[model samples]
Target chain A: MILTVTLNTALDVTYRVDRLRPHGSNRVRAKAERAGGKGVNVARVLRALGREAVVTGFAGGTAGAALRRELAEAGLPERLLPIAGETRRTVAVVDESAGDTTLLLEPGPTVPAEDWERMLHHLGRLLPGAAAVVLSGSLPPGVPEDAYGRLVRLAHDHGVPAVVDADGAALRAALAAGPDLVKPNADELAAATGLADPAAAAAALLDGGAAAVVASLGPDGLIASTPQGSWRARPPRPLAGNPTGAGDAAVAALTLGLVDATPWPQRLAEAVALSAAAVRAPLAGDFDPDVHRRLRPLVDVRPLHPPRSA
Target chain B: MILTVTLNTALDVTYRVDRLRPHGSNRVRAKAERAGGKGVNVARVLRALGREAVVTGFAGGTAGAALRRELAEAGLPERLLPIAGETRRTVAVVDESAGDTTLLLEPGPTVPAEDWERMLHHLGRLLPGAAAVVLSGSLPPGVPEDAYGRLVRLAHDHGVPAVVDADGAALRAALAAGPDLVKPNADELAAATGLADPAAAAAALLDGGAAAVVASLGPDGLIASTPQGSWRARPPRPLAGNPTGAGDAAVAALTLGLVDATPWPQRLAEAVALSAAAVRAPLAGDFDPDVHRRLRPLVDVRPLHPPRSA
Candidate 1:
């Protein structure tokens, strides 16, 4: 079974409005909420794909309880640790008329040093039974800057591969700890390496000690730099829908590829297909199965630079 | 002790942003949340004023639990009935640069028929110990339109004065049940009675069967029409701050007057003063006590008409 970590779990809420009016009272026409964070989204996709995945993270207060209850309802197994502060909420106000969304993201709870220590101890225990460990999302305030790096090292100590899905400093710091794989979206890739080209940015991460780097470019598809080879994969047709969970879907596919020791070309193809399928779903952490099945076969994978030796 | 009812309770959340962008992501700099509904706000003020107030109404789901916890934390006694549906949330996004707020109000949980029956039974038990029963705010979907009216009738049956603070159809329906007093802001009065003039609009409500009507006129102050007489009350000077809970503060002061059998002029003066004090406070359920005390004696209450006997 694989393990997914969400250090900054959130109660993701969505509100539908006729047309958003700034500085005015808006009566939400419809509302929806679920437990979310990048790792949680990856775990959701993993479970939906028939892989066993356990969610581990810090949850607390009423919003945390709500998050836990939702995880139970969704049947996503959890090993969440409780804390004193409440979980944060990310609200997406969808404007029906304009067909756009405005987001308000609350800064989640601050983690105490002792709580971080407890989390490290807890991860050590769980690492033994996991096939691979995936660390994802932002670090709440008060957490050490090299949190992912620390977690990556711990997973290694247990002889389990660690996949880091993060951005900015969190993504950069994890490289030295040498995660088996790191996934970053297009913008995050640029932000992390200060490089304009996806391939260059990914190579920089590889040079920094990551075994492989997969960068998701919405609609454009997935580009990967790995030890075995380099490849670019794309779906035959662009799917138009929410792109919120596309990156997580790719991470789930690529992680499965790592566990199964799939070839680089097949792994990149599957990642692109799954990412495209997720875009076809209305909400994050969900995908249209038929879209996945249809797109997977049609995904076009080509050698970007061939094997490093070649 | 006053019994305050908030059938549609809410987790009122506020987010402070540097500036609001209509179709962009906003990182909230600061956040604050409290249990709120018009009735809840009234109860908060009543408690702050050292009045004994017990809150009773329907609350459910996690948000309901949150509301209950806050009420407990604040030490306000409650007899809230539990339900199955989740409570709603109201988000206020404050734009620091714009110096304005945008509100997103969720349609609270829908009440089942059995819950309404259960509430009447619950209120029946509490009325005997109550000096006055205050029914405030909107009725959730599936609740009877005449919910406040039915509540008023129940309070009257137990020889308890019922004060209603609502607007539109809810206010209109409650009037015919003959509540002792109804509080409506100027816009609510216009919406309910279709009269532009504040005093005239209030009179229209009295004709619809209310024993008295109090209309809040924002910074202009308040106007009251009751059995004894009519009067217009104003603060010595206009004060600045959030006006979200001004009306609730007024209702708190007026309900206390009813319990104490204060004269009409003194009651109106106190209501105006308290409302202004609430405007000075940042949150709705709080008031600036110093402001309240300083402004009370200076409130100018001019008789709109001589006592009916005179």
Candidate 2:
């Protein structure tokens, strides 16, 4: 079973309006809500792929209860540690006429030091039977900066592969713990390594002890570098829809491949196909099975030579 | 004890940002949430005035639970009836730089016919000991359009005074039920009667069997017409601040006066003073006691002559 960790969970709310008028009253035409956070999304995708996945994290207050309820209704297993502060809500105001979305993100509640320790204790119990562990999303306030690094070490101590899907300093810190894989989108890779070239930035993370690095290049697809070799994969054509959960889909595919010891090229191809399928789905943490099946065989994975200097 | 009914309750969320840009992401600098709706505001203000207020309405789902939790934390007594649909949320995006607010309102969950009956049954029990019953806000979907009219009748059956704070058909219907009082702002009165003159519109409701009509005139203060006499009251000067809950505060003061059987001029003066104080407060359902005390003595209430034609 795959174990997914979302330190900062959210109740995602989407409001649809005819148009968003600044400083004006808007009557929302419709609304939809779901439990969300990067690892939660990954777990959802993993479940869709017929894989057993368990979610663990810190959740508190009314919003946290709501999130847990939604997860239960969705049949996603969760073991959330309780805290004093309520979990955050992330709202997306979708303009139906303009086809645009404006986001209002609440900085999640602060988790006390004891809460973090308790979460670690809970996570330690789950790691024993996990095929692979995913440490994803931003660290909430009061959680140490090296939380992902510490989690990576915990997974490794249990002889389980860990995948770190994070950005900036957290990503930088996790690399030294030698996570089995790290997935950073184009912007995140640049932000973490300060390298304009995706390959160079990915290479930097690989050198910092990540066994492999897969960089999502948005519509352009993904570039992955592993100890065995390097490869780039892309969907047959660019697909446009909600891209919110595409990265999480890729992470799910990558983790699945790591558990099965799939070849790097095959794993890269699967990640690209699954991500494109996620983009076609209307909401995050969901994908069209038909679309995934059709695109899987068509994904093009090609070998890429390392930079001459490297 | 005062009884306030909020047929469509809400979780009022306020997000403060540097500025509001339509169709653009906003990083909220601060957030505050509370249980709110027209009658809920009235109940909160009544509590602030040292009156015991009991709130009852339909509440269900996650949002409803959150609203109940907030009300509990605030020490507000509630007898919310259960429903299947989740409660709605009204978001106010406050632009600190522009000094303006953008509102996004969800049309609340639908109430089943059985739910309405259950609520009426519950309200019937509370009316016996109630000093007054306030039917406030718009009726949610599935509720009969003449809901307030029925509620007014219920109150009168128990020999309790009823106040209706509503608009359009609901206000028109309640007038025929002979509610003890009806409060409509200038716009609502005009919309309900299709008359531009506030006095003429108010007279129409009085003619329709309402015992009294009080029209809120925004910065101009309040004009009240009752069988006893007609009066107009204004604060020393127009107070400018958040006007979100000013009318509810006015309703609270008017309800208090009705229970105490205060004279028309004194009641109107109290309403005007309390409303101005509410405007100075940071949030709805709250007022500055100091401001209320200062404005109360200075409010001017004077006899008003009927329109020449009327």
Which ranges of candidate 2 are over 4 A from the true structure?
A306-310, B306-310
| Distance from true location, Cα of A264 in model 1, Å | 0.5
The native-contact fraction of candidate 2 is: 0.81
| Candidate 2 local lDDT, residue B143 | 94
**DockQ score of each predicted structure, in the order shown:** 0.89, 0.77
On lDDT, the leading prediction is 1
**Alpha carbon deviation, residue B25, candidate 1 (Å):** 1.2
Candidate 1's displacement at residue B14, Å, is 1.3
The residue-level lDDT of candidate 2 at A64 comes to 92
* Stretch of 10 with least lDDT, candidate 1 chain A: A301-310
List model 2 lDDT by residue over B210-289, tens digit each: 98999999878998878776788989999889999999999999999999999888899899999999999988999999
List each model's interface RMSD.
0.6, 1.1
Best by DockQ: 1
Task: Give the C-alpha lDDT of model 2.
Answer: 0.91
